[model samples]
Target: MHWRVPLSWLAVLCLARLQPSQAELGGAMCHKLGLRGECEVQQDCMCLCFHVTADNSTLVDAAYFGELGYELILFTPLVHFYHSRGILRSTVGPAGSAPFYRFSPHHREVDVQRHYCLGPYSNPSPHMYRREWNFDAWIPPNLHEQYKGQGQAILGDGKPLMIVHNKYNQEWGAAPTNFISISTLIALFSMLKDRYRIVYIRPDPRQNLPGFGADHNHAEDFDDHEHLRKHHPKVLLFQDILQQQRNGTRPDLNYNELQLMLHADSERFVSVLGGNSVIASYFAGVNIIYAVKGSELTGHGLKDREFDLVYPRLGPNGKGTILTVSTTQHLLQAAANEFLQQQGDTEAGRTVLEASHRTHKPHRS
Candidate 1:
């Protein structure tokens, strides 16, 4: 019986030895430093990029790259890693001992055909890009809920709203670029939050507005002159008339309930335009009078006609308030700079403008 027990123990020991340990399996899958034998045996291993910053040594985490199924290709002392998936591609190279990888996270592999440049310049204009528009159409429901929580008033009469003129739809809907324009729009909205009540104009279900059109001309014709006279007597006649007529009735009610009512009711009174002439004329009135740039009109490719009238010279710190006064490209550059300055990086504003002029392909006026 004792010999049989010893034989049973020996069999259990043999089975335990045959099965791999958890540490052994994990080690085979992931690279661990100082495990030369295991690393040399594996078909693929992790490469560590180290750097010294402020007298402290730091290691670049290559685990993210490894999980994406990339093999580190060594070229002498320098290493390069690349991955390709359909039309998207990415490459990671030694960036001063801290390896930096360019990745298109949507696809598993890199796209060799499409080369991407850095900065806001390499980005597409909001009016020129197409696929981006589709993506912009979808906003996470949670974000909408959050916006509502913040008292974001939509549709004055409690009607369901459709986005007629959102900065996201204006810039990203037509362009294949990062969210620089949209970011600027957010910053501007932030700045105006205390002074104005901003609302996105929802499309009327009965009214089908075209996705893209020329300019709007008769925007002012839609203003509620009666309402304006009663509440906002100081409101300009032309301004009240124009907002009533624009297709995407996204109007800023500058913290005045009377002005809001005048514009809100005016939206119900006017017929919307879809052509370039209409848009250009509408913008000519708005931009010329108030020095305010509407994202909706601007996204339709209208520069600030008010530039010559409002911003005759540079404002404080060589800053020009009329950034959206020129071509779409120049407007984008200026907007980007303005955004950076708002973020407390004043130097980045000029850098972005210079980079835009040098790198971005100019849009023909």
Candidate 2:
């Protein structure tokens, strides 16, 4: 018996042959969308491709894919951190990779999981801030063990350490917001200085990594360093530690590597928004993040909330408690409540900081 092929079936086969491969189709789609690179989707996973600046990127994005059990082929800047991680199948970038800001994948890449910059589409939660995104795979606790105690000799001073991170960048708006002010630092230091060995961290833009290029922050000059040096003599400055390490015979560690080492020793952190807060959330501790405005409060582009949802997952098994505040008053209050009230209460002849619990500051635009 001879089987006859239908004309419709033949037409379908011809159409399938004529259609571009998924990678080529993705490349064409990316070009049409004005993206520099392309995206390729395979069975149950996708190869997210982009060569954008690292500042516009987030390790959270990479982890999101990892949690979803996707194999990643990242071709972005600052690929050193992504190496050896189980999630990334492969990565292509220089250790000294300098990111040019002309191309941003937020608008271009559409096939991958995106929770940010999703406005202009018909999604219910345009920014997707209403829901939580997992960051468990971003920096596992095991990975942190390697860097732990490396900064202990440098930062250990017999007292429990608290890492304080501050960034002065105009990311959200033209004026400087989402930063811990010098006056606030003075108040915070005076409150907890004697009880805890406070380590202040603010990366200098001028200090470039040995192999990796200097991470850009569009920093505005502030005199907090001078203030800390003059007033708080015992408070360890991260820059000073870097300078000391650089002068001494030690391994050439980049800013992120040094941060990982120092932060591993710390269980508590006080940080401003942006990458500073993200990195601080890695350790299993209470990360008090201060942000006056951003996607955390107002959502990425739409409206819901991002901080309370995804911030905790940055730590191991979502163990970290991320206390987010907007005002300096609330920041002071959280510090007093978490650190002073709990730890420094019984310290003999220690000055107590009174942070009012009555006036709760809500997130603002």
Candidate 3:
């Protein structure tokens, strides 16, 4: 829902870590958020501490603490939001807030732990203290209304629907992040289109590719659009992604059309180290199809199987088999079909999709 962030926010986030005056409480800005008391940056039993200055504003020093042994996972303009793949903007905060500082959650579950930090860091948010609330992982708290369109996508009347999440095209060092090149995704889609309508989801052309140290190419540098157009003319671009960025601005969390689009559409989710993978991993019933490839691919655990929801977990019925498939060519189509059959199309409004006897693409083949 928001537009291009002003340069100021971008500038502050440049380092994402800075030395704060240890003596001062929350900064002036922090005071405005209501953290009046002296706010010292100290590690909680589980939370990362933020420095409060004279103004009472909180300061995030993720890198410094990370060096001291705290694990820091920072994503930026290159990381996609869990709700969609077309747009790439990264932050662990609920609403794509900038320069987030996370402490190891009281619970390892990210979906449950994030609510503690909602709103201003200065506010009386749950994140200020640690407590265990007994609730299953349902959905992330404070989701903007737009992220609610998932039900519509589930309604193909049992026809197969697939969401292929192509994370980043960039490589981490010499290692690949289980990346399926756009051309390959196009090929897979071609193989699947006859049986199931497939959606190829990836970062929008306007977003930055991962700039590990030097991949910071201009937005125009991305060939996602070019490749999709060139090879897979029939593959859809997960509509939400291109539509929002057509005029030059990437989609914002404030009005996440991506969340709505993915929710309404995606069923069998496939991606490696992408945000969409994160969504599928935690949200119950959606089948998982991934194998780790990047050394740092687990960077934010965005695409890793290890990361999962916390408090609100799906009942046993929500559990689906996490398939293991190799990148070998001969195995892909058959494996994908088997995976889909294991977790068939979810009924509209149901969190768990029922397993169907439907064999993807068999009739056509």
Candidate 4:
């Protein structure tokens, strides 16, 4: 007969994959999530697409489009001035992850992946906080459903809207993604309740409560319901984590769901962000994060390249103002003063800035 392995041994084997040696975790963290993949620099490639701006305006090609195409080695008979496929993505804009490669199936022979945008584009990373291009096939299948049924939209009703998200995954850091303290968020949202409307992007749908897998069979072990409802009054609660399991309906934003006007109407967004927020706020045209005092580029899961790629205008924690950074309060106030000041909502923002600058003197790293 055959012998069966103990459950304990199985558990150990499963956990081993997560604990890639210090060398693996220490090196180049993938920009995708900074939790997996060993690639440090993020595989870089270039493509020429028929680009369209967010307002349906066509954008002029950067420098020499034909030269760039030839450099990319595309032997094409019809290289149009307007990249019809368009500038597909950026760290800051509706286009989503600018670096995540994509290829048009119809033009599979053309190896270069396609990219574009649907709105006012933020510059890619260091250039600006967001970028814009045009869309080819970026539309989601659930467009109508999300438009009709997507849970909530934290819009600005004469208030500065701020979206904050914190993810928890067992693969990050020494333990799972635990460094993002919910209490810290509560404190943050509480501080600006009067001036800002706070929205909390839930723990990623892919994530599960402690001790529970994707199946969430042991969701009972998690008991943060009262804590969330009671203490998190200042912040908007989208849904209850512990409740989704008991109801059998997984309450979280689906990939398709994000495309339907998710942040299109937002004023500002703040988070200990990742690819998801970067793209969503790109859609909204606003993504800002509070650089926690003394933390390098926000925290453990962030890569400097990713930070630079999305927001070069702001620096990590307190390194300098633009290149090298300053305080989130100082930097953000400047951005708010400049970017949204013309939008006719400056007085309140300035007040928040002054308050934040005085109280949250982001310690220079």
Among all candidates shown, the one with the greatest lDDT: 2
For residues 1-365, write the lDDT of model 3, one tens digit per residue: 22343335433432133246531333443343332323332221112223334453333321111110011112111121211221121122222222121211211111111211111221112121223222211223222123334435323344455666665544433434555665556555654565565566655434422211111211123466577767766555654444544434543322233433454344465655433444443333344444455322243434322323221122123343344333424224433444433445222212212222223321110
Q: Over all chains combined, what TM-score does candidate 4 have? A: 0.39
Q: lDDT score, residue 262, model 2? A: 81
In order, the Cα lDDT scores of the candidates are 0.25, 0.53, 0.35, 0.33
| Residue 145 alpha-carbon offset, candidate 2, angstroms | 3.2
Ranked candidates (TM-score, high to low): 2, 3, 4, 1
Name model 4 segments beyond 4 Å from true.
1-83, 86-161, 170-173, 176-180, 204-226, 240-260, 290-365
Clashing pairs in 2: none
Give the TM-scores of the predictions, in the order they appear: 0.20, 0.65, 0.46, 0.39
Residue-level lDDT of model 4, residues 1-365, one tens digit each, is 11233435323322232334522432332232222222112112222212233454332212111111121111111121122334222111111211111221121112222221111111111111123312221222111222422333323254555555544433322333322455545444545566665555554433433221131111122223346668766666434423443355545433223323334344455544333333343333344444333223543444343345323311122122222123445545544453455466677556657755544333221
- Over the full model, what C-alpha lDDT does candidate 3 score relative to the true structure? 0.35
Q: What lDDT is reached at residue 143 by model 2?
A: 24
lDDT of 2 by residue, 1-365 (tens): 11233435423322232325765764554344343432432222223333323343312111112211011111121122233231222321123211211122221212332111221111112233545442322333332455568768776568888899887755644867788888889888887788888889875554554432222235677888888898899888887777778678665645556667788788889998766676676677788888787755675454425565555655655456788887888888778777876764633223333344447643321
Model 2: lDDT to the true structure? 0.53
By summed lDDT, which 10 consecutive residues of candidate 2 come out lowest?
66-75
List residue ranges in candidate 1 displaced over 4 A. 1-322, 346-351, 358-365
Candidate 1's TM-score = 0.20
**Which ranges of candidate 3 are over 4 A from the true structure?**
1-160, 169-176, 204-224, 239-255, 294-321, 324-335, 339-365
- Give the winner by TM-score: 2
